[model samples]
Target chain A: MDMVRNFHMAQGLGETSYAQNSPLQKEVIESVMDITLRSAMEACAAETVSIADLGCSSGRNTLSVVENVIRAVCERRREATQQLPEFMVFLNDLPSNDFNTLFSLVPEFVQKLKAEHDDGGGILVSVAGAPGNFYGRLFPSSSLHFITSFTSLHWLSQVPAGLLNNEESVNKGNIYMSPASPPLVATLYFERFQKDFNMFLRSRSQELVVGGKMVFSFIGRRSHDSHEKINECLLLEALEKSLSILVSQKLVTEEKLDSFNLPFYAPSTQELEDQVYREGSFTIDSMKQAHDWTIHEYAPKMLSNFSRAIIESFICHHFGEEIIEPLFETYTQLLCEKLVAREDIGWSKIIVVLCKSAAS
Target chain B: MDMVRNFHMAQGLGETSYAQNSPLQKEVIESVMDITLRSAMEACAAETVSIADLGCSSGRNTLSVVENVIRAVCERRREATQQLPEFMVFLNDLPSNDFNTLFSLVPEFVQKLKAEHDDGGGILVSVAGAPGNFYGRLFPSSSLHFITSFTSLHWLSQVPAGLLNNEESVNKGNIYMSPASPPLVATLYFERFQKDFNMFLRSRSQELVVGGKMVFSFIGRRSHDSHEKINECLLLEALEKSLSILVSQKLVTEEKLDSFNLPFYAPSTQELEDQVYREGSFTIDSMKQAHDWTIHEYAPKMLSNFSRAIIESFICHHFGEEIIEPLFETYTQLLCEKLVAREDIGWSKIIVVLCKSAAS
Candidate 1:
């Protein structure tokens, strides 16, 4: 999980592109609209404001997030009888993300912005792509004024180091931090999250000015225990079952499946808050949890496509590309059948807004 | 024509990966041994030597080129009784390249470097990937020392602007600057190359320090005319013929076929020399031509895979992925059949070594 090298959203603008399959992320973006706007408004003092959307994978939502920030800052300026500032927007992602589709929409976006502010207000929008992982520094010091990331922090920098072939068989059949795993496996995942999340905060704090604000939303659970009843792990459980089926049929090796682990951790709100406090760079302004996704009629298929877009490169790297079509077919069928009986299975997302402390 | 955004070498280490299909490029790298060694020996005076390889598509060859540069620099230091300087190597390519496969081999590359040196030789090697096109600025001012690009400068920054759907109905069936193409179509391709090559030289001039050297090799023609007996353009001709057959079968649309154009231009030796003089930054140290390849055994499908690895993402963007398998099959069949009667067909490569002028 050298995230920059190993990960990519699916390529191009076809039926399987991340742009076409990312409605869940779009919905979550809309869910945090108020928080994103308020933070942008608070940081509208500069004549040139910079906004970054970390892990802004390929799609219309990439620009949609930037649009929300622009509108928020513009409205605040109008309310205060001030002129709009020129915007510098950076769309950040891993090196493997499909930047072509993201750039294809720029012409129309620029035209729409010009038409909306047609009074010769002279506001300029300059967009550039910064391709790298957000767990490290991507911008110059004190350069980013406002930053946002959606549904992306769950991906750690790498898989936890200690989980490979332990004597006690930790995370043997499981691919992620699931309810069926023992408590020690869960602790290893949490420790990795703490390390990664701390580095992310440290890097962003160095890049942001003293008064800059960051708003992020990612998957988490309401309960702090590993055996909690959350759908995040259950969805992984279903996919793991599909992979195990492939292994049993001699289509995939059991050893290959055992070595593969998803670099993900769904933390609780208290865990995130604790890390934020210990990291000592930013203060939380607000935190909200929404238990929105469940195994409903559309959720299973939608989740399959979403998972396929994000994780297919990693899986195809381990399992050859020849197996991809059959593998996904079997996984989708199993996911649809499993959702019929698991009404209590769903995941919660936690959104937090924070401000960089001047005295830290 | 957005090279960084659209073009990519294939992904993974599997059968279709560029890693498995690039033996021809590896052979070409070995053929340029003397020039690479001479350039490294001349620049052994600095404590930090910077080297860049443009169009460094994924494979064993990418690292093999860097290994050659490092070894040359080290051997130069050993001969002169001087200490080894810290080396910074930059491998550049299109943004969509399979960098995961490239980065995965880093640990072993480093291990091999250390084992050979063995004395506490203070020879630190740092490798970083700069993902973008070489036709524009990719590095800071006066930052590069030695640069090498192989088999890639023939790609224009874009398809020449004037050749699309013109009223003359010229180049109607042809896909490239070939014997079948009208003279005007050939002129347009040359003009585009002239502009792009001029820009490339101008940008590199600003990046390299005075007396710094650049070595680049690309596919070219001995004659200035496109109608000459060169196999490079003929190879494309056969593929275009295969695509046309598919169009006749209604498998691929005529409109789609008509819209496609390869962003390539094969220049003559004098053409490159003229541009180098006009750009006024570097002086040609040496230029050599080798007519190396023709359609023989292992050349047909080998060319197809080489083309596919470079152009598949672009083709899959326009035509659906379903056409890929059948398309290559028909293409391989046509190429094999055409190669039977043509014995004089071959591609000539022109390698030029240049040094930056001391005066602006």
Candidate 2:
């Protein structure tokens, strides 16, 4: 998933406005935190609980969401006793994520949260960091009572291998999920998503306690066909154009260029539901499609970083820096063309909050 | 001139954002008024003088600039006679303009102005309409004391006949300013601008009274060399692409589509200065380039309405309404592509305030 790595690196250089400005995610996550923590407080009948945000890049937003959850839990606990529970938060992300950036701001965030809760007069909150990919396993099993991942998930470590292979379904001209392209690319895309999603459920099932709750939000397509409106498809087209420009310019050998494709695909809402149901280990409590968004509010920054961090680095790493500028310009032009053509109706994000089944 | 007609119609609908967000223009023109009116009041040495906004479409922004000028002049006059001049305003546009739209709001505007001025004691102001193009002569000679046009003067009523007749120049394609195009297009564009501009000045010379300050703030480019940036050329290329799509769909005949070109040209700062100096009529006191602005802000809306107002009624008049949507989409896509591809540098604006040379 060098593609994923590149994407993160590139998008990190500039402001990821979408991640920063998603009031929708912020509001929804806050509500989810309140609901889930209140339920946890009632179920545990314990003094306090720990919440973990797995794959929490920068950890700032993660701490915020967890703070809200703790507040709600403590508010409920305060109803019965004069003393409040001491809450702990573990913020996790890839090891390479700017943990220092997150840590530097931790003191300020903690102080602010303390001041806010000072009036309530009892709850104590502490935050810790755990930097690792959630796919392999990050946190200790049964350690996290409540977990959340907003605007993440749905991303596999890499593009599904079957998509790149011809024998399996869903391959079209070595291109996948682009506009004015064959339908098979989209089909292959969705099938791969189904496989990866099953893996996510299996992994999450092993990590969570029987009563643990996990909330995940991810990018998705509006329709179930999967043959249309795939988010990653547009990004791939941009990469393809950039690659072709590289090959034509002789920046990279044609063989090296042809051997790779980006490893991301946004699943459809119906397809996601189907995947989770098949896992059978977890019971979904709630799932909602965040179909509409203000891309202008977030896209420009995300895209700027995506081009610089991922595309430029990928091209430079494989070939050299010679083709970087051309590749970026071509990629940006292609992306803008696709965006305007789509009229900004490109991606649908899905939010799902689920609990491990009693049987499991 | 029909092209200019299209521009005037589209100015409000597609080609100009200023028409919709008058407040933006109001901010700039208000400052210009503050400067010009102070100078005009000083030049005339009169306590009270009339002010008019030439080609002030819908009179919204014109009223604002006028109101500000009147208020300022009254403030100055209060120091002397304790009376404000009987301020009269003439909001001018073409016969085809939305006069009813302008008139409907006049009562409220006048009442508000009166109320604001009344609070400052006694500053009388009355407003009326001038429904005619400034190009052909709107006001009676020497009848007005002060006039301001925030951003309307760069437009010529028609593309220059010299450039239109020169097949070589016209055939080069996009015979106006556009970035990333041939230098010849800018050369031809400026040459044509010189001719039409000479006419513009020759005409304006007869309209303004001695010491009457007319300010023209409009879209312009940075470089004197038309070769470097030809924004207008890009706009036409986009239009040609749209036309090509029409020909492919057999929506319009190739010959008819081929003959058409846009009439508007955004001039550079030097070009405006040269034209004013060559006119031997108006003496430019101050010319400053305002912030760069995108024509795309208004062009999309204007292009949408072009079919109903002019193109459908003229070029594609025989074609069914079914062709309209496709034409617009095709046009917008092409324009957006061209715009997105180039350096995000072209499409700027300039504001110049000139006084009719008393010596002339």
Name the candidate that leads on lDDT: 1
Candidate 2: residue B147 lDDT (0-100): 68
Per-model TM values vs. the true structure: 0.63, 0.43
lDDT of 1 by residue, A35-82 (tens): 788888896578778788899887999798888788778778888988
- What docking grade applies to model 1? incorrect
Error of 2 at B118 (Å): 91
Chain B TM-score by candidate, in order shown: 0.95, 0.76
Any residue pairs clashing in model 1, and if so which?
A231-A346
Q: Write one digit per residue (lDDT tens) for candidate 2, span B1-360.
A: 353233333223234323453543555566466566665565333443546666666536766666667667777766777556555455655444544345445556655766877755444443444444455444434545666665565555655555445443443323234454355545655666677667766656655677776666776766666556344344455655676677877887655553454445677788788778777878877787755444445555454443334334233333455666777778767655665666553345676778877887
Best by DockQ: 1
**Range of the 10 consecutive residues with the lowest summed lDDT in candidate 2 chain B:** B4-13
Give per-residue CA lDDT, model 1, range B63-151, as digits (tens).
88878788888888888888876665677776666655565665467558757776784355655555666787666556678988988
Q: Which regions in candidate 1 have their CA more than 4 angstroms from the true location?
A: A1-18, A29-149, A156-186, A198-216, A220-264, A268-360, B1-20, B33-53, B66-147, B157-166, B169-186, B202-214, B223-264, B281-346, B353-360
